[model samples]
Target chain A: MIAVLAVVQGDIGIAGLAASGILVAVAIAISLWRQLGLERSLLWASLRALVQLLFVGWVLQFVVDPDDPLIFSVIWLTAMIGFAAYTTSRRAPDVPRVLSLSIVAYAASAVVVLGVLFGFGIYDLEGRTLVPLAGMVVGNSLAATVLVSRQLLIAANEQRDLIEARLALGLTAKQAFQPHLRQALRTALVPQIESTKAVGIVFLPGAMVGLILAGVAPADAVKVQVSVMYLVLGSVATTTAVMSLGISRELFTPSQQLRRPTQRP
Target chain B: MSSLDAFELRGVDAGPAGSPILKAIDLTVPANGVTVLAGPSGAGKSTLLRLLNRLDDPLAGEIRWRDRPLIEWEPTDLRRQVAMVFQRAPIFPGSVIENLRVALPGVSDERAGHVLEHVGLDVDLLDHDAETLSGGEAQRMCVARALLTEPAVLLADEPTAALDRTARATVEDLGRSLADSGVAVIWVSHDTDQLRRLADHVIVLADGAVRATGHLDELDASDDQLVRRSVGAP
Candidate 1:
């Protein structure tokens, strides 16, 4: 199938890569015409992605084979999860020890979801299966974590008076936070749900389209895409739910009283 | 109704340890009459009310209710027994009746209407939206909500400050009625006129400690500057 796609689409050699410059020039042109002042950021982001992907491809030369040792797969995926967590927690400043917390979230979600896949014999626990699967889980979980944690802090701060008022009315800490937790979960999950809802109709998803272009049958491609979508959704929901519960618990002291360390002035 | 007869705070220091807002506060809130806590700004009057409900624990010392330490009492149980009405009325997003029913489950519409009447609000306002209420109306709504809990003691922090003179008079009468009905009314007020008119017992606080405690007339004769300044005695 790879050979067929390479024959049909032609090799994406160095010259072909140079041809992609036209897209960048178009972006630069729009940036100039609109005076958006985003030319620098756009240029930097494009260059960074180029360097990062090329380096990843070079590194994959040594590790892409499923025959590679499982130890290498575990170590590599752990590093990827660490980086994903760091990036996600950066967006949620109010979350205490956010980096460590995100690590726990991403690792746990990836483990359970990947374990289920392994149990089903979909892929062995090696780099070929582990890297891509972990990528899907970690990347998608980052988005959900950022949304959930940000909304959690925002709700806690914006609704402190209401929450404390509930607490004042003889409700426990968890009961007082029920509304805020509900709001956070709703906000975090809606985007993923919407994308899944519109998956093929609004736009052909990247994974399915790629697989079809690579000469997999259209039905086969669709099945693989559906599986990926379900797996990613499950991973994200688990990450968000776990983190939300933990963060809500953090909002209270050991004595079950609210601790407003993140109260906005 | 419960065996708890009063709130006892013995050397009950609160706030942050280094600079406590309420320091060594030894007093008892007996389950009767109006015990008015009076002070100038920053005297920790609101903190005292919060302590009664275990909103925050003291930095040191103990607050007991019914001879049991407040920390030992379940917070929910304690709060139900010691209901609080904030200064701004804590008007939330809901209908008036929903606000009333949030704290007290299964509060019948008739009972709700009765409490609103006691707070000088018409039962017709039951369907009125909480956000649309006037300041006085919101305060009254909160009071009616607190009353539904059938609190053994009501701790109000400037509950009538938002009310107009007529509304304030009505709430004052309501407080008197609550006291008469055997609810211990612990009203925190800076308004000397209100204190003089309403307080059966006055606690004058200054620098986060009680400067004086006695009858209103007796506090008016106190020589301490905290008492003299707060009571406004010439």
Candidate 2:
């Protein structure tokens, strides 16, 4: 794939390869230094991601060189979105397997939000335009899912007796969980809101950083960053909402019983 | 003239080391009145009370409530209709109303206030977090929570042991009043004086078996060595 892409798109030479290798080594050293006393899992995950990304970079060189790049890009992004949904739901068994719904919700929201801002004849489907925006949406949604699931689980466990008592007192299961459910949803969304508030002053986000590095003007990079931020926020909210609703329904039966956690043999 | 005898224990044996806490015990408490389980420490009094609520199942024989075997009772329904107050009050975190609300979902704030009053708790204490309440106040809230269910039986294990003398007397009074209002009260306590003061009938246990069963006065009149010794007779 890398050979084919080199033939098609001119050469991305040994210089590019050396730069990537040197950047990766530096990133690893920095991460290991920062995580000095922590568990080895972080270091292990970084190494795995590096190897996986290199493999993916080789494969994408061919996939992106195809006659129909748009279709290939759609397929690639769809796979990312689908896997994000699956990983998030599996992490929270209490969440319903709304894989299809989450995919549609996230993909449709991301495309609309990203496409309008980028596809408005202002920006085109360049690698710089598409890849970073998708990464923001996919990554944020995964984190949101984690936050939502952890908060919901804690709220549910802590208030179990109160929930049972409420059920006995003639409230439906949904009614019993309503307060905590709302709280969990709020907790999941708040961090994203705070980051959005901190956009230019507290930190320059990844999209702007990448665009600025690629020699785009500061104002232009900030504009693209703003659009990407909206896409990310929208996609994550839709995915989290659909997932939260589905997970709540799946975790509890219509008769208001909690589903037993799936046991392994 | 009752809502059916809500509980029955027959040949029930429970305790540690194969030595039953309540051996071959048979009891049918009336649907109303304070049924004091008066015994010394380790006499299986608490165990017998727990069995009524199915907190612990009998080792041998059976326990039934409303003609249905205790084991067959739906756990949720059983819990709702039969509330157990532990020896030391276990107040879960949350407001006083939240603690009271634990047994009855959708119980109105007004009704919670009423139940609190009925359990001898001041209405002002409703919004206070239960964990911070004094032992007596917490125990009263436990009773209030149980009462909110309109439970057929209240199984209390040493509900006042951790309270001061004034608080203990207050809780004992509340238990008697609850029985007077037509709820079956099965209370376990080692305080013979409180049992005599509050119980309509007493079931005394020495080891795991019933050593004496009758009204408090009858037990007092009897020549049982434990009772004689307990009464401080020389």
Candidate 3:
């Protein structure tokens, strides 16, 4: 516990930590002054984020050590994937096999994205690069997976007659569901694509800002930011594609008949 | 097992498990002529029709299509043979020809025109956007799409319930003509006048059970008051 606190204190000195607290205080004060009814939530969320981030920082100090084996990185990545899957399953309890589907989606994106980064030697093969890169991939992919799972299920429910009409005309389940799946995928992916398009022009991304603040050259920071943006976009596309296809299969029976979704209460 | 029967159901229980809509139904659908399934709302007429094409399976008992169990046939093959037209007339996002091609992917423009004309639609509408079609035109287009598969049995589930009187007459005539050409037409109609006009055989359903199964004359003479009333018999 002391070691973790020491590490946190070294990274952000006590005065810097207090300065961050002041920022939260300002947010809470504004919430109260405006009667937004969000002061309590704002305070709680800020405190929780502080604690969680500090804990993660402390853990990463050891995990990213030069002496540590790559197995520790693998374990950390696996744990992140598992937690992401669990979170997605909780968010979409009605979707069948959502836990397994999420696991596959997150893991597939991480592997594919990380493989390109390291396989092509864009980044060093170490805990430092592996953990944060995979974290970004898993984090960005989570929302896309949840969006696609829910959207596909919604399409199945709202477009029941259309799907059944196609099925009645001797179309296979895949054929009947192709259009809806494409729609869901588009719905899930468009925001990511749009953000990717507007990344530098609209506003600087976090990674680029962090690099620039850390005194990296503007051109170097831009390069890293562009790579990160592409990876995030790729991860979103991969995760949504896997999730939408998996949910599409679950929406039908082996007989190619549309299985009516259990109505949400 | 008769060759004349298109579908034979024995002790079929359908719908949700605990609260089935069609309960213990034993019936036969003829392979020729128009058979109108007449009932009040919630009588499971549509449910029974769905069972014939394997859209929804029965909870218990068996359904045979042409002496073969429904489960034995490949769903795609079975559906191609037993095409259905829905009430709302779902139109895909394309021209009328593209919609027709959903059933027969390579359907030629000439063949598309012929089928459209057969359903009382102008062939000139073939190139128009399907979503631009009027409700009646869309419904007839759906029928034309079903016919593209060259199905042996045409299941019309309240196909004209949404159309105007003129449009209803047109669709009803199309069904009649299809049946006259030897394709078994199983139609569901809440309108007693339509039952009187198109029924060569009538299956009167009430609360999921078969109240009467015979010609319109037989239904008119039914001892069950609900059955007689279903056919609008005084």
For lDDT, the strongest prediction is 3
Evaluate candidate 3 by giving its C-alpha RMSD to the native, one decimal. 3.9
Candidate 1's C-alpha runs over 4 A off are: A1-11, A120-125, A262-265, B1-4
Q: Scored by CA lDDT, what does every candidate get?
A: 0.82, 0.69, 0.89
B1-234: candidate 2 lDDT, tens digit per residue: 264564677887875436666788877755568877766788787777766655456779898878889788765577567766766675656899877665665788899998888888889998898888888888788788777777777788888888999889889988888788877788887776787688786777777777777776677788887964443223
lDDT of 2 by residue, A140-227 (tens): 7887876776676666666655554454433456765776778888888888899999988899898677656666667776776777
Q: Estimate each model's TM-score.
A: 0.91, 0.61, 0.94
- What TM-score does model 3 achieve against the real structure? 0.94
Arranged by lDDT, best first: 3, 1, 2
Clashing pairs in 3: none
Worst 10 residues of 1 chain B by lDDT: B1-10
- The digit string of per-residue lDDT tens for model 3 on B109-137 reads 99999999999999999999999998889
At residue A220, candidate 3 shows an lDDT of 79
Q: How does residue A141 of candidate 3 score in lDDT?
A: 89
> In terms of TM-score, which candidate is stronger, 1 or 2?
1
Inter-residue clash pairs, candidate 1:
none
Of 2 and 3, the candidate ahead on DockQ is 3
